[model samples]
Target chain A: MCQLLGMNCATPTDITFSFRGFSQRAGITSDHSDGFGIAFFEDKACRLFVDNQSAVESPIAELVRNYPIKSRNVIAHIRKATQGKITLENSHPFVRELWGRQWIFAHNGDLHDFHPRLSGRFTPVGNTDSELSFCYLLDKLVEKFGYHEPALNDIFTALKEISPQIAEHGTFNFCLSNGQALFSYATTKLHWIVREYPFQHASLIDLDVEVDFSEVTTPEDRVAVITTEPLTHNEVWQAYQAGEMILFQHGRPIKQAMTVVERLQREAKDPSLKRVTKADQY
Target chain B: MCQLLGMNCATPTDITFSFRGFSQRAGITSDHSDGFGIAFFEDKACRLFVDNQSAVESPIAELVRNYPIKSRNVIAHIRKATQGKITLENSHPFVRELWGRQWIFAHNGDLHDFHPRLSGRFTPVGNTDSELSFCYLLDKLVEKFGYHEPALNDIFTALKEISPQIAEHGTFNFCLSNGQALFSYATTKLHWIVREYPFQHASLIDLDVEVDFSEVTTPEDRVAVITTEPLTHNEVWQAYQAGEMILFQHGRPIKQAMTVVERLQREAKDPSLKRVTKADQY
Candidate 1:
């Protein structure tokens, strides 16, 4: 198992506040600490920092906690290796280039016997199931759309169609981003919260730190934070139903779909649900 | 023009000593201070750190100077930004994945009107003549070898075959690596030095720091350093020919070839110079 943290914002923002408490899970609060990695996207480019060391101890993670690298999209992971050796390559979040843009992916759950055919378009340098799955997902994207980049909606559609089939192997919870948007899916556990205007003070669930959002943020700023577990105690965090996928842009969910039980239930009520989903919002 | 630094070692060695002096070129010693980046390879994986901030002022660069990250293959760059904006995306050394391996590259020279046909297999995330040329080179490799990874010698041959054509646009000095070996080519300026058994005291040219290598390294340790300019004043650094390419592995040059002037010079005596070169070693 692993831990994931993702942030999408209407404006560029830093993860120092949330990352402080979340990184504590690596060694202080709980133990998922095999290694840790984080990626911050600035437009089509990304600044990625990864370490095979525990997040609590890695000097790179220390920089992440102190440096206020503001970006509209961010994805982070603290890994407890389930499938690969404890090496730098095995650490998530994994990054790849696609459609002339940098794409970042991180996983939070373990998959069993999940080896898909890789067509060599996208390949994994690390011998981890997480990286393999990420490569498979990207391969599917290229296979569907060819070399030209598809629209965000079309990408969301392709992911929605592919997430369940991969999830069939085992627990498949992940967070993915391409600077413009964040797409998240969960089969077992995941949570999210949106912070906007009129925000109140929020206290960390894992540490004795608190932040008054009103003092630090503008009214125009909106941010969506998704994690494996809720990082704050005061804010209301929404849990994702199993097999649900959410695409976040500009700090809100713009499109969502579920591939398992929820889809079947929605299809029973509306036969026209073949291409649409009830998971439009939380 | 920018500054480039690279190290290839028979054993895992830290670049802190070299980086401490090299980083000074970003602001203190010279004015190539637009931005900077460094990449350290651990097997097939690389830990990359980049900042749009000057290496002398960037906190990330400070960490790199202080942290002793050990690697056999390392590449670093300090940018003057003649080609692209001083953004994180444009900072070199740039990285891309091919044949399940991460390739790291950095250029110290500029190119003019160097846009080549891209077959969409690899693309540049940042708009720099250096990155564009790297993509063009990778596209050539994939075009020649398809999805399969060719042998290092074959890759070296492909690069030798293509280097002069790209150099036709402008200066094309660069250092590239794929963990297993490092490939370096230069049209204008580049230098290298190999230190082994009888290591001596070396003093920095940019900073007042001296290290007695014999005290810090074992006899088994051999290191080859490549840079735009020599970092040490006491060490004997060999300058690359006007158009020369060298492949480094195990801290030594195993293969070398010249593309333009040197090739013609050698060919004046022997027509057999078509497939062979006098640049077999430094």
Candidate 2:
């Protein structure tokens, strides 16, 4: 229904290279071109740019492509209008403030009848199931911890408890970030790649563009890119299994407890359960 | 200490011409150049752009000058950093969502020892006295009317009651809008002008730029421009009295009851009370 792109890094890094190829999907390489949005985090704050126009034609997207905005965490989305109209208010990724820090969220798949009760300060300004879900998640977080912000591990635990329930309705792939880390979950399609020391040349799958990461990055620079689909031809993009979730911080994934999806798999002998599979393994 | 520019129009209007001159104050004609931000309201939602870079040199600012984004209400600020560090988070105008509508605010003056007790959902993300005052106002609004948004007249009354209290600490000139109307308050420097049917040529004070308004506007179109200083040299501007607040809607000022400043001035027989006056009549 839509597409997502996210980046987490050990240092402040720009998304121009990956965004160039990813944005092409909005109108050129493929058509998910109803609207587009991007958020670049600078510490606890972020600059969010959104337009109802196709990314290929939007002046704001052109600025995003040409200007190199460095950030530790970034999230972007190109919409195909699965649930909402093609209006500026309906564009993703949507942003809300929590505990005095900005939180950004973008969704890639459609959910059927997935509106959860929202009883907190967070509310959706647009009429989209994506924004509704984001508000619900934020409400759940506030419900669990009140006005105080919880630690990363506590947040991951809360998400692990909540993602599977929503995934039951339909495809629930999403990327969320609050400047500190990126949290991603997939029920259908999602991929990620980490670029680290001794990086090599990579070729874009959509356009005739190539970049040698070694030339532009120091040995200490590390970056993790997560997207709905692979954007490069040469790099090994790891595909996420259905109902799987991952948390990325400081350029790499930190090992955690089994996701609710995995836990449900261990209890899959129940007749009411459906098997969650990788579908496409890299 | 800073500068503010706001526009409320009867119809959607692009602010390129006025912004061209207003932005010059960031680094060219004057130097309130710690950072700058602008917000353009498209209905209940808005597009907010902020940068730590000076408006004269920032590429984002350059894009703003060139691209004609239309909006009914707009707010812009050029910061001098009286209280916070010159970071992206400290830039104005600041935005927050309440009752599913985005509220935008920008301040042109400083507050001294004006931290009010905040016991509500709204919180300041940056360490600026201006943002603290905004959060306090929003918190007060929520306190008065829980999750439901009150009527515009009620909001005006609440602001009329609260603005004078904050002004007691220091200069408290500000412009606030929620896409419905623009609310402005001043204790020192602020001016406003309304342009309607009879349009004529106007020249900029900060730059050698001139434009004939009749060439681009219709008789039905009306716009009200509010700023710390008049941007155009040819147009007549009206200055605000100390502690005065005005509510603007449909490109015209709606008649309101006496502001607290006027009330205090009428009761100025007390030896302890100081008189508030319009220092500049024109």
Candidate 3:
């Protein structure tokens, strides 16, 4: 399985320290060295970089480690080939234009036998199931809400209604951004934490490194980090519940929800659930 | 680049709703379909899955979208090839044994000429810098503290000292876990957020999905999410400062630090910094 790294903060900050430890797993301490990529959000757009090299050995990775480019939102990943071939075209943290803003996405987990028909609005650039689903999702959103962006609450309600149909296929967990807020969801595993004033020292599990946050950030700066696992040795990291969804903005979660297990179980017993797919029109 | 999905809460909650939306990018909406993987932490260990396919097309990803596996800590990623060929050997959320516990890691960004000498304490199973770095980090930690695990704070301090040296070689941003807390850092870009009581509805940028968190979570449940970018449409996401480090435990940022730009500038000015490499070691 691949690993994920993300950050959301009230102020622009770099992730050199945590990234140093996290990158070690790409080839040094663990597997997951297929390829790596990252995106840095600068307002409504992002600076993205990807490499079909391990984080430990890739020349580009070295530049990231040494250079400190600050941003308010970031997403990154290291590949462990699951579906597509190990090529630059199939990197994670995919970027797209939506509502006049650049949206970024990354995913973990797999879906089996999920081939959905799509219109021309959004399409996959690669042959990964993850991208296909992303396109289908955007298509549905535009179809439902049109050009004008809807209120977050309204969109959330629609998402809850549509998610179960997709979940029937397999494990699905992901992170997404539009240079504004972050959205996250999980079916199997995902974790996160928020950092604010009175920051202390943190150490990495993968690397023999530590940093004192209090010395770097201002009292007004707040940050939230979401990853597939805990990145620090001395900090509190929270876990996501099964089938929960969350939204974050201004370094804080603004929305969240849990799947209805009973409903899902009922659907499992019904043939109607099996018919849900991208083929079904919204 | 890869994508990350994470969730953290005061209490165990399901992430199906969010996962459904986020997973779509793996292949359906975005292009991270090289391979997909996820890890769910129950207590100390994790349930992990990886597929060399897009989450949108993979039945496994679909199942993830529907399944409601509950956990407090979780990590997920979608790969885009960079170094190693797309194969199971290169899958992420790489796990290793440390102090009789499993450690997980995922990374984004590339490294340049980051070849460190290994002492055999940890070795690379894949041909990517990510794994090599992981092993090197563990080796360093073990070398510094021996078999017994040191205090998280001490580990953080050590990591701080070691990260810059490694980062000097290339870009380094990553997420790591030792079954205790989630650690994250970035040299370029990363963002994060926290969610607590009174969660509201959230919409996803990649999918037509939304959820009303207030409907499922309790007021006591606090969650922190860190990512490469913000994941929601309405919530505020904070960005990391240039060369910042942080640690997360219990869904909160307990520690953080900023990179010493002055020191880095001095290092850049000194030709000696260029001579620092594995060849110069020992």
Against the native chain B, each candidate's TM-score is: 0.93, 0.93, 0.89
Q: Could you arrange the candidates by DockQ from highest to lowest?
A: 1, 2, 3
Off by over 4 Å in 2: A256-260, A263-282, B255-258, B262-282
**Number of the top candidate by DockQ?**
1
Write candidate 2's Cα lDDT for B19-44 as tens digits: 99999999889998899999999888
Which has the higher TM-score value, candidate number 2 or candidate number 3?
A: 2
For candidate 2, give the lDDT of residue B2. Answer: 95
Docking class of 1: medium
- The residue-level lDDT of candidate 3 at B256 comes to 89
- lDDT tens per residue, model 3, B135-253: 77877888898777788788777776666666766666777766567777776667778877778888877777777889878888777776766678888988876556777777778
Give all candidates' CA lDDT scores: 0.91, 0.88, 0.71
- Candidate 1, residues A77-122, lDDT tens digits: the string is 9998888998999999999999889999999777777879989988
Superior candidate under TM-score, 1 versus 3? 1
Interface RMSD of each: 0.7, 1.2, 21.5
Instruction: Give the C-alpha miss distance for residue A155 in model 1, angstroms.
Output: 0.4
- RMSD for each model, in Å, please? 4.0, 3.4, 26.0
Clashing pairs in 1: none
